[model samples]
Target: MSQPAAATNAFLVATQRALDYAGFAPPSPGATCVLVFDSTLWNTHIASVHGLLNAVEQARAMRFRFERDREPYAVGHAVWRIVLAACLNVPISAVPLVSTASGQPHLPGTRWVTSLSHSGSWVAIAVGEADCIGVDIERSPSQMNLSALMPRFCTPAECVQLSGLPTPLRETRLLALWTRKEALLKAFGTGLNEDPASMAAAENTIVAAPASCGRTAVCHVRDLDLPASLVGALAVPAGAMSHRLYWLDRCSNDVYGCNSAETSIRSN
Candidate 1:
């Protein structure tokens, strides 16, 4: 298995190839793809800024992309812009991504559903035909204290179940559960602002939130086998069974490189 950095690179290459296979090309294959990293920059905020910028630059359209001219609220926005461009053929600077009153993002004049997530240095985004979808990626072997975070994030039963597992196993289990819930919350547009302790994941299923939250959206969870270093989950309102996966790579020459797809979306 590839280490985290290598695996992420592989995914980038894979995504770019998938886009090519899908018949979209913003630039030549041999050109460099841009992936900017600032050693002095903090990971938390810069992730979103770079993610959005990269997505726009890759698509060669910035109309819908977030304004890189200002500070970013979350790296997820950057990923969202790129995913939108790749899937919808729109520009990152496009004004369609205006937020709803509830903070849900919407594309103007369209019903496309979009979601974004970032873990460590990598981010993933998913877009679908008007179906509520949430995507999340978490860097595993997390530096956080599982014991303390588990109680705060896990359900009581989950805590009990985790306690019975070996330390290594327990950590993986806990992270998976956490990623699932985080995905759900992102779908809700609440993210970590919601109390994780109130959320629960059992049997790879997220228990429906209380009726007070308005309507219950259909939820589906899948473990994306990207790398052991990262845990990714997808939450979509129960909908269709088709999705295509792609890998993307950025070179320094203001051009993006595409790697052919190694996996295709299958019926769930």
Candidate 2:
């Protein structure tokens, strides 16, 4: 776990408000909670590293080619351990992990759905009972020029919204759409194989039954609140639709609450 709580608390509070502004509902108990962290936190909780890795034998036995890449690799692994430990209310050493040929990390025999994403010093993890889930955090300070990328990812309506927004909002709206599409893609585990703009999922609220599941499959996608410099989104299978944002820096504490005034939903 991250050693200090003060910084983590402040970051989480700001992120919680960001989530509220993006039309996120007060986290439901059954939906998994999303936890955000800064990459720098990977160094502070150094003392717990060994135990955290050993708890999951698969992680301990892993191999890497370059020594320089080890730290960042370990950081991602450690974040997963820390988040899983916090969620299970258990010690980091007790968490177990399994690797699959598909490369998506799994929790041995458990049904928990998880997704991890990091960009520009920030890392986020979303866990829950949903059969499939994806979470993404994007830092927009250095994001690409809006005009160059929108045609590749945005639906016609999204593009119209982009053109209609005030100059100050153009970039922000673009990032929001990108993050939402990325989250949806991650949830499907389909990577870039399918067109994000054509997913046909509702803008932030609709859960559609995929044709493959005999019209019974469903996935929910929506935006997340984060610091002004960052944007985020979450996706979950309909089986588990509740969600809450959490701060897990110390591995055990509720740093934010859902008492903020709810904002009206924004239409894309």
Candidate 3:
């Protein structure tokens, strides 16, 4: 495994320790859990990685009451294993794996959801059995072509609004809007091919409807107050969503969970 990012290594170690202390080993009698992780950080050792995969497969096999080869599902399953191993107290190898029709990862038979995104050197994921959830991370590079993509991915109004801003602010706003729409699409279970510009973020929610899995969907946008280095957005069900934003500087074991009361937004 590549060394975890300087900002996240310590947090991963502490999380590992907590799981170990909780007796969260693989092969629980029978239970289901959500696993989340940054795909870029996991190191895959054949023996160790497989061990965690086995644990999750065993759990899934038990859930389905069958015996079959779960190994095929374990090969590209690194991130799934790490998150399950930590959050669910199981061996990373033991997390069950499933995918949506559009190829988005998911935990089957329940509302438990997980999504992944990678930007530059960083990766992020979110796992929960919430009503709906999506998380995305992007590397803020100095040379992103805002003008070139604005027309393609942004609405006419948004493009005009973005163009009106000072160069520096316009660049930041373009990226923020892009990430928000992308997160909304991921949550809606549709990738970029879904034409995200149809959706617009207004007053903390996305207003345009995007097509996903052959159905049109909308999302509530909640801007997360992370460090200036990071611009994060979350999408969940409108009106009833509970958005808990956090800045997890893992290398320092510092997780800043936002405590502000839940805010409501309407996408319609």
Give the candidates in order of lDDT, highest first. 2, 1, 3
After superposition, which runs of candidate 3 have C-alpha atoms over 4 Å from their true positions?
1-14, 18-80, 85-91, 206-208, 250-268
> Which residue pairs in model 2 clash with each other?
18-225, 19-225, 27-243, 31-242, 209-217
Q: Model 3's lDDT to the true fold?
A: 0.52
Question: Would you estimate the TM-scores of all the predictions?
Answer: 0.65, 0.66, 0.64
Candidate 2: regions farther than 4 A off: 1-29, 45-73, 86-96, 99-102, 200-203, 207-216, 239-241, 248-268
Question: By the TM-score metric, which is better: model 1 or model 2?
Answer: 2
Which stretch of 10 consecutive residues in model 2 shows the poorest summed lDDT? 256-265
Q: Which stretches of candidate 1 lie over 4 Å from their true place?
A: 1-18, 21-79, 89-91, 100-103, 203-207, 250-268
lDDT of 2: 0.60
For candidate 2, write residues 55-164 as lDDT tens digits.
34325435545533444445555656655765565665677656544455567666576788877557787776556777888887545886667678877877776787
